[model samples]
Target: MAVNAHAASARTATARQPRLRIMVLGLRGVIDVQGGIETHARRLYPLLARLGCDVEIVQRSAYYPRERRRRGWRRITLTYLWSPRTRIAETAVHTLLGVLYAAVKRPDVLHLHAIGPALLAPLARLFGLRVVVTHHCADYEREKWGPLAKAVLRAGERLGIAFAHWPIVVSPVLKETVETRYGIDATLIPNGAPMATPRRTRHTLRRFDLQPWRYVLCVARLVPEKRQHDLIAAFQAARPPGWKLVFVGEIEQGDGYCQELIAQAARDATIVLAGYQSGVALHELYTHAGLFVLPSAVEGHPIALLEAAVYEVPLLASAIPANLALPLPRNRYFPVGDAKALARQLEVMTQGTAATTAERRALHAAIRANYSWRKAAELTSSVYRNVARGGWQHG
Candidate 1:
């Protein structure tokens, strides 16, 4: 049988009996948080709301702040809950609070993103709320986690799949893992990418001291697993003359990883670290890039890569399973962590001859055909609809 990796097309005309209510947990905040899960929620919940599902995403107050709390974006309601800003306690505290809030409000379904927060799936179920968990990635595989944290993450995955009324996996690779290991089949609803408008002006380019179509761009948080250090090494080895390398991600905070990366970028005149940009600034960067690269050692259906593909930028990534899932030429990929191979590809790709108009159209068509917000939301709402029908229940 084919893998359950398909999403429903956004059939806007579908009819429904009294609307379904969904409470979301397990995210920092959808308002420009650094992780891919944030991006997923930012794109998803509004569409869910539009699809006749009553959607409310519970966010950590630390990230949303007092003034921004309880604000609604598009059609979706943003509900803020308290949590410590510390990495370890944040998800646990916020989600525990979110579950209590859900118990009080009593939504029909609770949607949790990522395994960390999904650790509370059993608790959510015990509280008499139908639970749906989206496994964004295998958090245990990340390099930053210590043994205890990794063990906790493994337990999170187990509890999330075992207790959820419906388990959703972001990619087929993850779907297979859940089935092989836990003997549970997951609904595979892939991550969605937005249709972005290209910034027509050169203001952002000039601000970053970058020339149009003369830079290689990589957008990811400066984490070890993301491997921005490896990208920097590869770019230096390539030294694609006249063409600068630009990094677009969070940078102001001085964690050990961020400090090392900031100092490294400072050494190279051609390397630019454009810190924490969104909106038009990010759109413009996508529009004018000569090439886009994602050399991360870890990923789960990257939205950034899809954003680049939407703009028809020449794509290159590490030969990881997630990156390989994208439809790019095989030659576009270098071996994972292989700076020498990446450099060789970079040296040859410096010209950045963009695809023709026909190619650009085809890329947009492919995005519509494959990854779409409307479709993913429709698929997610179907889970809510099923929960309303009172068939699947897990203890």
Candidate 2:
């Protein structure tokens, strides 16, 4: 049977006829380039709009003066003074603004993206608005919080999970955590990446004057948990001839860990600190790299890993369950946080172009066929409609 383009376009047009006005309460700052949640919003927002959902990512006003912000200093002093619940007050202000904005602007469905905004879900419902929340992280107890603070955080997480009309989780791992720990049932919607073109041009690599097929790429935030310093050290110790390591991400203050990474990089010319690259630059780096490595100790199924899979750069990633869940070969994973183990894995991938063209195409097809923003939007729309019809029940 032959299908007509005209009819298909018409069907697509009609299928998206119902416009869903949605306001997404986001954390990691709307413009923060370093966080995964922000990257997810950036990729999904336009697609949501195309799917007939009016999406707005709510952000907070800068808490400090311009000079301090420019110098990599956060307003931690002020935030610390707020004591046991600094984020609550900060997030409440944003949520209040979001709720007020929603009341006036009147979005049909209000979606909250992180734990902070889940604190406002009950109020959003009280104001006669439909609510949705996406849980983006693991148990707060896993974080470095004090005993009293962790207890409060855990309680708050349970409340947020138990009260939302629809709670969407990013992985089966997170789904289990929520169900067992908070007794909240959630639908698992894993992370995805936009289909990327392979880098066939020298233009992108030329910008940094890097040699083609000679550098390994690691794109992530420069945080302790990300274990980027491990990548730096591994690249240094391996010191593979004709191979370099490029780190692409921005660093925050007080973490002061960026300096430590730079010092480690100084011992080897192969390691380049490229800071933050986005849009075309980021895509190009993923496309042109010899291999992509992720040394993260913890992640919620990172989008970078998906991007690497899409571009068919044989990934040498952590041995974490999330990475294991992907269809990559058993040889791709290294024990988490072991630089030497990571170096050994890198040696294997860098040996030669071992992956066949068919394998590359298969991996790309796997990600595109199984995971996409269009499919995400469809599932989300169905969930929203179901919740609107009162089918969704929270714990």
Give RMSD to native, each candidate. Answer: 2.4, 6.7
Q: Which prediction has the highest lDDT against the true structure? A: 1
Q: List the residue pairs that clash in candidate 1.
A: none
Question: What tens-digit string does per-residue lDDT give for candidate 2 at 175-273?
Answer: 888889877678877777687866566666887768876899998888677788788777777767788888898855445678887777787667788
lDDT values for all models:
0.83, 0.69
Displacement of residue 25 (Cα, Å) in model 1 is: 0.4
**Cα TM-score per model:** 0.94, 0.83
What's the count of clashing pairs in each model shown? 0, 0
lDDT of 1 by residue, 14-81 (tens): 45357778888998888877779988998888888877788888888887657656678887888888
Query: Which segments of model 2 are wrong by more than 4 Å?
Result: 1-18, 29-32, 63-93, 100-106, 126-128, 139-153
